[model samples]
Target: MARDRSRRSARGNRLGLVIVGVVLLAAGLAALAVGRGLLGGDLAATPLLGDRTNAVLAQQWVPYVAVAVAFVAGFLALRWLMVQGMNDTVGRLYLARDEAGNVEMPESAARGALEQEVADYPGVRRARARLTESGDHPHLRLALTLEDDADVAGIWRRVRSEAITNLRGALELDQVPAVIRMSMTAPARNPRRSLA
Candidate 1:
């Protein structure tokens, strides 16, 4: 959703920049043409400035200023358009937590769903899920908190498989992949405590 919003905003900005550029370019061209006539053409001979000779000289600067401003404005507009194009190539991603408390099914609803699934793992105390896009596939990176003595590899494999299954089911997507990472491990408790 965020990605879609960003793309829309960028597109709007590009359109605005284009409109401003066109207006400025047209105004600049008109100003330059008028300035040229005022400075060097028969209009220059008019004593509007009280001095026909000085009138042309005084107006010569107008065309130069108009042309320079137009060029600068056009360049800026082009640059903005380029930036907007680049933005379209790079969309948005996010880290979210699942809310439904279901880990067996694909939590492909959004970032939140995946996060919730991570938290539901047996050894996990907390979990964070990040959604990313690579090529055409959606990749999920999950960071989980676990007990220190937990079987890290076993838990990681289980989480990865479950997440992939759930996401694939929820999103109806085949390219979903998951990576499980441990963020922290709790200290081991004494097994003999129950006997005491």
Candidate 2:
């Protein structure tokens, strides 16, 4: 859920930036046209700052207000940048809750179990798993290193059918979204065969 929200937020941010960029571009073009006399307006003769605006800037509190606004904007920008590096990896999650109290499980246990299961598979050199979001609806990221001669498609199918299924059953979840990344290592040379 948190991952989805983050993605949506990123999308919205991009959309806002695009909109702002387009508006600024159009305004600049319009200003250029006016300055070139293409649009019947005397841009050079117009005062960049009006008398009323100058009076507001001349106030004693203006500098303080400007500094405060600058600080606030800087803080918000920093926060946004930090958020881009954030991940919603779950630490602990509630497996069950009732009058008997809540049954909690550390997310690392689940991740370890899943990794072990995959690593035990034939031809799989190594496996790693990460659980993200909430316990009720979690997302899994799996990374697998395989032997050069490993059956990639077969292993993929088996993981989707067995490993993920077992994880879902253990977590008592209806569905667990997962992403698997697989890579093959260089083939090992036969010891008995001498290099010519």
TM-score of each: 0.39, 0.68
Q: List the residue pairs that clash in candidate 2.
A: none
Q: What is the lDDT, from 0 to 100, of the residue 108 in candidate 1?
A: 43
Off by over 4 Å in 2: 1-8, 11-55, 185-193
Per-candidate Cα lDDT values, in order, are 0.65, 0.89
User: Any idea how many clashes model 1 has?
Assistant: 7
Q: Compared with the true structure, what per-residue lDDT tens digits does model 1 show for residues 1-196?
A: 5457777987898798799899999988866766679546776444455576567768869789979999999998799778656522213332232685423322244667767876777777887776665323466666788866666787778776786687666655666656567856646575556654
lDDT by residue for model 2 over 1-115, one digit each (tens)?
A: 5657878998999998899899999999987877777866676568778999999999999999999999999999899889878777888867898998988899989899999
Q: Model 1: what TM-score?
A: 0.39
